[model samples]
Target: MTDLDPFTDLLDYPMYVVTAQADTERAGCLVGFASQCSIQPARFMVWLSKANRTCRVAERADRLAVHLLRRDQGRLARLFGAETGDRTDKFTDAPWHPGPGGSPILDEVPAWFVGRVEKRIDGGDHVGFLLAPETARNLTGSRTPLLTLHDTHDITPGHPAN
Candidate 1:
């Protein structure tokens, strides 16, 4: 805390709810480090913290689901953003459905998709998964106010892997 201030630089970018399924179990969390890495093939990469319970379930998953939350869905963000999957069943409180490969996609998000895991790379504290979308759904308008890091000030990671 002497000179390093990650929070100062973390306020930008949109927040997303990432989900995945393995067997009968589904897991997800609010992801900050994700991007559309490829435009030609329309690929996206989402980083899951190693300490996240979702990460563990995703390890054996062949598909993952990603969702975009509205700015007004602050409470939804906190449920997945601040609560620890370690002791909480996130789906119990959120409405969702099994998408491609059985990945649970949140129902209230503006947009959501189930993707096939193309590849995975170890990135120190987190694991990056490259996803090729298999099926997608747009639940809201593109002009919707998306949830951003700035809107999640009241929510803290219940499980900080780092």
Candidate 2:
């Protein structure tokens, strides 16, 4: 696995904030593993760390919201990436509204979508949540660039990796 570090380190993917709600509990976290897995039916997949609070909440959630941050929104990235929800109220600190399926939509995100959880796949330390997009929007229009892993490389992980 150590041999793969060099190859993996070279990959710089876009980062996202995934939010979930179940009952009265709400959680969100910065995610580095997510992509559009299908085009015909428009399916997306977001992998959440097993150790993350958001992942725990998502286990019972029917839906989740994925948000794309702008390149300039480093502060927002840090808030979600560097602060653990176990000790911090991330939703109260950030401006957001209840979106489709009761997922929290961060106001600062440039683009976002609410997706129904289609399936859950166990992927090592992370669990992949296959999503079927229910609603989507581009708050900052189409030209806005998304923040990538390179843009957030300096930030530390809020949740400990399992």
Q: Write the per-residue lDDT of candidate 2 for residues 86-134, one digit (tens) a residue.
A: 9999988899999987899999888999999999999999999999999
Q: Candidates' TM-scores? A: 0.92, 0.96
Worst 10 residues of 1 by lDDT: 2-11
Task: Quote the lDDT for 88 in model 1.
Answer: 93
What is the total number of backbone clashes in candidate 2?
0
Tens digits of per-residue lDDT, candidate 1, 19-92, equal: 88888877889998899999889899999999998999999999999999999999899999899888899999
Worst 10 residues of 2 by lDDT: 138-147
- The lDDT per prediction is 0.88, 0.92
Superposed by TM-score, candidate 2 places the C-alpha of residue 156 at a distance from the truth, in angstroms, of: 0.9
